[model samples]
Target: MTRAGTAPAVLLVVVGLACQEIGASFAVLLFPQVGPLGMVMLRLVFSAVILLAIARPSVRGRSRSDWTGVLLFGLVLVVMNGLFYLALERLPLGVTVTIEVLGPLTLSIIASRRASAWLWAGLALGGVAALGGGGWERLDPLGVLFALGAAASWAGYILASARVGRAFAKLDGLALAMAAGALLSLPFGIADAGSALLRLDLIAIGAAVAVLSSTIPYAFELIALRRLPAAAFAILMSLAPATAAIAGFVLLGQHLSWLEVVGIALVIAASIGAVRSSSRAARETAEPLA
Candidate 1:
């Protein structure tokens, strides 16, 4: 009965992630001239506002350690998103995102010994390899560098997120991190976006982008995480690469090969197996009579 109640929220989280990826791809069209840094700044600033209003995280009683976690996570978020936007300039959304997935994939394999973890690794590898196999003819070195940078930052975000999640109940950690991230990106955004940011149409478009790609996704994740274990949550998130692939095809018309499709399936299977294993682990840990 309890599990049934949680299923809908968990599904919504995955869907929310999909929406964010697809929406962001389309949203970029609204700001073709806004440049990468400017768009990132706008999204972060607006997302911070939206999250702040929704989560309203208070720092009154938080410990110093908690603040440190928030700061670390905020820094990671800024770096990851910044580099992602930068890479998008030179690389197709599908390619860059697939590469960035490597970080979380590595993270997923770190703590578990279950056969399912290996399955997930296989999926991760297949998805990544498929991306490589269907090579980009004009692969940009700078683009690859930014994508890898995003990957490293993503790794930081994952570890920091774990700590931040532990530090605060509910969405407090995420809310604070968003706020800090916005502050961190302001200077860069203003410099890159410049006076063009003041245009009404651009501001409106940026706000919509923030709502679709950031605010909605974060809310869904918070709700879903509250209902699921961390391991389960991470496993579910492993699907982002597949989701991004589909999103790319739809919004950007970036066609992926059959190998890419197979690759995505492998990763998704691995993630499911990993989550199922974690669920089993949870059961064993909680129940002694079994």
Candidate 2:
């Protein structure tokens, strides 16, 4: 794709990451009342409803492989969201996001043959290490483990989404997968939130969280993934930790020290380097044909 074509995908990713962080901050505010499991349940249930209503996916005519892909995608979504919220319950948003980014960074590094890709990965890892170095003692080990689990699930989600996107037409696969996720999380949601889940105000907030965090970002990512290579997509998503830090400062009153600021800058630099590298590689590939 031309630079012009790639620009929109980049913009979508930026917007999606911003929305996701903001929604996450909002979810934190509700966590005390509903708990993490309840919050995940609300996000999945409402997001599933919105996507299913919009896509109206057909159940008929899907092959067993197609269903399998969708099921796997849904399972990944469930695990990713659950673990992320659980981590959020114990860790600062920025720190959690920084650790969770390792999953995609690992994916990108393994996918690339170039040594320069390893440099970018090293820079990103150094930044994350700096960000967490000072406050590691205060952070719960269990929370860190949860974030790592979310990271693994996120990597799975990325790979599964690409396959499911190809298998089913225009959001149908996403819709089905989201529905399956909702069903899978429903029991936990009920058990945790209880009657609080039925409150009108909580329901309204849950709906907004679903739209901001799940509906919008997922749609943007699914569309962007169709156009962007997985490695490129992962690099673009490197912005998440920086955005999460900003959201934490703005919404959660979490202050960052100079080291953390430098960490964010390093991650941003690595993302830019990755994008430029990918673009240059694309240009070189086309040059021979031209």
Candidate 3:
């Protein structure tokens, strides 16, 4: 697409990611009342309801493999959200997001056939080490572990999303997977928050969180993906950590040290480098045939 045509999509992606981070900040405010598990359950339940209502997916003709993919995707969603919120309980939003981004970066590196991909991997490791310089004394060790677990689950989510997208039409797979995620998280949510989960005020906030974090962002991203080149979209997404940091500061008053800022920049650079390398490789392969 031309630069003029791509501009709107770029705006959409930026707005979507900003909204997602802002929504996360809001969820953090509710942590004392609902806890991370409750927040995850609430977000998943509301997101599932909204998607199912809009997509109205039918399961009549799906194969066993299709169902399997959806189930696996749902499980990944459950684990990813649960661990992410758990990490948020103890870690700054910017730091957690920076760490979690390693999941996709690692996946990209693993899928690439280029030797230079290792440089990006090393850069990302250096960033993580910088962030962990003071160890558990400065940052919660358990929270860091939870963030890493979320990162792993995010990688699984990416793989599963691709499979489920192939197996089902439109948003049907997403809706079904969201429903399954809500179900899987229901028990843990109830155990954590009990009857408090049913409070109307909390439910309202949760609904808002779901819209901002999932429904609206997903809609915007889907539209942007159709209009933008894959490489462009990937590069745009590499700005997420910076956005998260800004959102953390503006919405939550969470401040990062200079070291943390440098760490985040390194990770963001590594992510962008890995994506650009992959994109260049793809283009070169096509150029040879042309």
Candidate 4:
């Protein structure tokens, strides 16, 4: 893609990420009312409804493999959202997200064995240690564990999503997967909040969350991915913590410490370095004859 073309795509990706951060931080407002599980359930329900309405996926003619992939994605999606929301209940937004990045970063490292991969691994590690600081108490070990669980589930989502994309065209797979995820979340929603889900305000908030977290982000990311290199996208994603921090401050008023800032910087540096290395490798592979 041309620089001019990639520029808008990059901006779209950034905006998509920003919307995700905003939706996540806004979820805090629901903590006292619906609690984490309740909020997750609502978000899933709303997201599924919206996507289904848009995609109108039909399972009747789909292959068994399609069903299986959708199921797998739904399972991971359930665990990811549930655990992420749960972690937020106990941990600060920035801290929880920083820890959650571990899963994807680890996946990224495992996908490659180059020097850049190792450097990213080391930088992410240093960032983790720096964030954790003196001990686990700074971030709460249990909360961190939940965040890690979310992260691990997120890794599964990434891989499954890739497969789904290959299996089906035009993101129908995602819409179907989201529907499955919503169904899987139904039991939990019933168990955790039951009739509370019927409340009008919560429903409104859930709809808003669906727009911010799923619809807008998905649309922007889809367009962006087509225009930008995967390496560039990955590098841009390293700024997740910083966006989380800003979102938390603006939406939730949760502040971060100086040490936390340092940790974010380390991770960002690692992400940038890794992207540079990967881009260089890609360029070498594409080099013309001398």
Off by over 4 Å in 1: 3-7, 114-123, 134-138, 226-235, 277-290
Candidate number with the higher TM-score (2 or 4): 4
lDDT of 3 by residue, 145-170 (tens): 99999999989999999999998899
Over 1-290, each residue of candidate 4 has an lDDT whose tens digit, in order, gives 36778999989989988999899877878777777888888888888888888888766887888889989998888899999999998888887887787777777666555776987888888888888655657787778889989989878888999888888778688888888888888878777777777789887987788789889988998888888888888888878888888888888888777777778788778767766776676677669743
**185: Cα error in model 4, Å:** 0.3
The 0-to-1 C-alpha lDDT of every candidate, in the order given, reads: 0.78, 0.84, 0.91, 0.82
Candidate 2 on 47-156: residue-level lDDT in tens? 98998899999999989999999999998999999999999998888888877877766665565546688798888777776776577666688998999999898889
lDDT of 2: 0.84
Put the candidates in lDDT order, highest first. 3, 2, 4, 1
Least accurate 10 contiguous residues by lDDT in model 2: 105-114
> Candidate 2 at residue 224, lDDT?
88
Candidate 2 global TM-score: 0.87
Greater TM-score among 2 and 3 belongs to 3
Structure candidate 4, residue pairs in collision = none
- For model 2, the stretches where C-alpha displacement exceeds 4 angstroms are 1-12, 220-236, 274-290
- Superposed Cα deviation of residue 27, candidate 3 (Å): 0.8
Compose the digit string of candidate 1's lDDT tens values, residues 175-258. 899889999999998888888887998988888888888887877887887787777677778778777877878888877677
RMSD of each: 2.9, 3.0, 1.3, 2.2
